[model samples]
Target: MQNSDSDFFGRQGDEKILYVVRPHPLATTAALIKIYIISLAIFFVLVVLGSQIRVVSSIFYVGLQQIPEHLPGMR
Candidate 1:
């Protein structure tokens, strides 16, 4: 596979070097599937992390709000 990319295969079909991720589009289908799978996993992980952060922050805020109740002079 030469790096010149004269008649590269594209996602649509054979194209003339418009853009070349790979020299042959034969691997495009598998590559796209892999990319989708990886992205989905990352998305789910991020969602879970965000929810956990929200829960923790809410608990911290609630603790702060209850501090005045424990103070003798502030009551």
Candidate 2:
């Protein structure tokens, strides 16, 4: 027998559900834009740092060449 006191999902007759809260579309869009800008800034900073490190390493390696190749472990 189907029970009138309960619906198909099992909620009682007295139960009432409140409306779901959500952010406005414009607010959500602004948040996404902020995240994208911050991500781009971090990416550019890393690229610049990587290039700087390569340059410094090359300069240091050139300075090491003054030592004779016959020294132990030197190639």
Candidate 3:
């Protein structure tokens, strides 16, 4: 069956289209704002965690050097 402009996705002749579901503009805007805020918070948290990891790794490496090796040809 051929589809008409008013018909969607090969709808039958006896089928009636229901009201289209859509988010309201304000709801869309609020959802976008919420997503943006959550993204920013995650980004900041990752940045802080990354820096802390780097600091901890550096301290670990420095501490490693302070320990003397007991192996034969290793100073």
Candidate 4:
């Protein structure tokens, strides 16, 4: 009787330095699709966050520049 580990852990016999895995076409396609979707979503989120940071930094810089230079201490 074949042990269930073969199916559970993939084909098992001997460990090779480099081995090829031939998965089902549908499985490969589905996995690639999911990776692409997740990567795209992450890319979009980063873009939005970067835009928000840029806006906030610009506002902070402008406010700092607007501060009065003539404080009544070291004059």
User: Which candidate comes out best when scored by TM-score?
Assistant: 3
- RMSD of candidate 2 to the true fold? 9.4
Better of 1 and 3 by lDDT: 3
Model 3 TM: 0.49
lDDT measured at residue 35 in model 1 versus the true structure, 0 to 100: 97
- For residues 10-52, write the lDDT of model 2, one tens digit per residue: 6567776455456899998999999999999999999998877
RMSD of each: 11.1, 9.4, 8.4, 11.3
Q: What TM value does model 1 have?
A: 0.40
Screening candidate 2 with a backbone cut-off below 3 angstroms (N, C-alpha, C), the clashing residue pairs are none
Report clash pairs, candidate 3.
Answer: none
Stretches > 4 Å off in candidate 3? 1-5, 55-75
Better of 3 and 4 by TM-score: 3
Model 1 misplaced stretches (Cα beyond 4 Å): 1-26, 55-75
Q: Relative to the unseen true structure, what is the C-alpha lDDT of residue 41 in candidate 2, on a scale of 0 to 100?
A: 100
The total of clashing pairs for model 3 equals: 0
Q: Comparing 2 and 4 by lDDT, which wins?
A: 2
TM-score, structure 2 vs. true: 0.47
Q: What do the candidate models score in CA lDDT, each in turn?
A: 0.63, 0.69, 0.72, 0.65
Among all windows of 10 consecutive residues in model 1, the one with the lowest summed lDDT is 2-11
RMSD of 3: 8.4
Relative to the true structure, candidate 1 has a C-alpha RMSD (angstroms) of 11.1
Tens digits of lDDT, candidate 3, 2-41: 5555677867678887776668899989999999999999
Comparing 1 and 4 by lDDT, which wins? Answer: 4
Candidate 4 pairs with clashing backbones: none
Evaluated with lDDT, which candidate comes out highest? 3
